[model samples]
Target: MSDPRVAEHMPLLSKKWDTDVAKKFIASKEQRWARDGLGHWAFLVDGRYVGWGGFQKEGDEWDFGLVLRPDAFGLGLRITREAIEFAIADDRIPFVTFLLPPSRKNLSALQRLGARHFGEVNYDGARFLRYRLETR
Candidate 1:
C-alpha cells in the first residue's frame, strides 16, 4: 500500500507501493493459490474492500495474517476469528502462526482468541514476535 501507516510495521514490504508493485503482489498471491491450493484473500465489508489477508504455508506450518485499512482496524478481531474458523474447517491447517510487529502494543485480542506467544523470529531481515494458535 502507498500509505506509510500501513507499511510502518510491515517488514517484508521493501518496495514503495506503486502500480508495478501492486500487480506483482497480486500475481504472487495467485501463484501461491496455484501452487499451494490456498493463498491470501481480499476481504470486504458492506460491498467495500476493507483489507486482504489469509493463510500462507511456510515450511511445515501455516501462517495466518491480516492487514486491514486504518478505518477498519476495529474489525480485526472479528475478521481474524472468521479466518481462523475457516482454518479449523480445513483439515490441512493444523495450526496458524501470527507474526506481529513489536510496535503493536495492544495484543490482548489475540490472547483472547487463545493464541499463545511462540517466540521471536527474523523474517527477511525483519524481527517479529510470533504467536501460534491451534485449530485442532
Candidate 2:
C-alpha cells in the first residue's frame, strides 16, 4: 500500500507503513473474517506474498477489493476472475460492487468481467466510480 503507483488509486491511504499499522490492519482483516464469516486473503506467487484483497461487507452490499504490488499488477484480471468464480458459487454474495478511484483510467478488465459502471459515489470523502457485477 506504500507504493505511489498503488496509492494513486487509493484515496483513503493517508499514512506510511509501520509495524503498528501493519498489525492493526491485519487485526482488522481478521476481525472482519470472524465477524462476517469471510474476509480478505493474501495472494502469493512463488511462495512470496504479492497482495491481499477480497469481499468486504458495506452495509448490505458486499464490495470486492483487489490490491496488488506494482510488480504483480498483471495478475489482477486472473485473480479477479478466480475471486468472482468463488462469489458465484457462494450463496451469500448475489452481487458485487466496486468503488474505484476516478484516477483509474483503464477499467476495461472490469467491464470484460461483466461489471458495468452505473454511477459514482462519495465514500469517506473520496469520490469513486461505481461498478456492479451480478454474482448469481
Candidate 3:
C-alpha cells in the first residue's frame, strides 16, 4: 500500500481478530517506512487485496510482518514466505524476524516456514514471540 492509502486503512487493518496489531503499526508509519523503498506491501490475490507483508526496521534488525483478511488467512502464509524471501535478497537485511503473539495457529504456520524462535518482547501491552529466518 502507498502512504496515504495505508494510513486510511489503518483502523480496518488493525482489527484485532481479523487482522493484527503489526498491520496497524505499518499503516501508522507508512510514510516514514516507505521512503526507503522498503516497507509493507499489500498482498493481492485474484486482483483483490488479501492483506500485507514486507520489510521494516525493528530495533537493531530488519524484521518482517504480515496479516491477512480473515477469509484469506490460510493462503496468506504462502504470501508471507515469499515476501520474506524478497526481503532476504537485500544485503542490508542479515536476518528477518517475525513477531507473533502467542497463538497456536500462528506458531504452527510460522514453523512451517522454518522459522525458529529467537527471543520475545513485550509491546503495546502484549507479549510477542520473536521468530527469525536467517538469510546469511
* Candidate achieving the largest TM-score: 1
Per-model C-alpha lDDT, please?
Answer: 0.92, 0.92, 0.69
- As a TM-score, model 1 comes out at 0.97
- Considering TM-score, which of the candidate structures 1 and 3 is the better prediction for this target? 1
How far residue 36's Cα lies from its native spot in candidate 3, in Å, is: 4.0
- Over the full model, what C-alpha lDDT does candidate 2 score relative to the true structure? 0.92
The list of candidate 1 runs beyond 4 A from truth reads none
lDDT at position 3, candidate 2: 80
TM-score of each: 0.97, 0.96, 0.72
The lowest-lDDT stretch of 10 consecutive residues in candidate 3 is 9-18
In model 3, residue pairs whose N, Cα or C atoms come closer than 3 Å (at least 3 residues apart or on different chains), thus clashing, are none
lDDT of 2 by residue, 29-96 (tens): 99999999989999988898889999999888889999999999999999899999999999999999
Instruction: Compute the lDDT for candidate 3.
Output: 0.69
Residues 5-110 of candidate 3 have per-residue lDDT tens digits of 3334333334433346656665666964756557778788999998766777876777787756767768857897787677668788888887776643447777
lDDT of 1: 0.92
Q: Judging by TM-score, tell me the better candidate of 1 and 2.
A: 1
Over 51-133, each residue of candidate 1 has an lDDT whose tens digit, in order, gives 99999998989999899888888989999999999999999999999999998889999999999999999998889999999
- The list of candidate 3 runs beyond 4 A from truth reads 1-27, 104-106
CA lDDT of 116 in candidate 3? 94
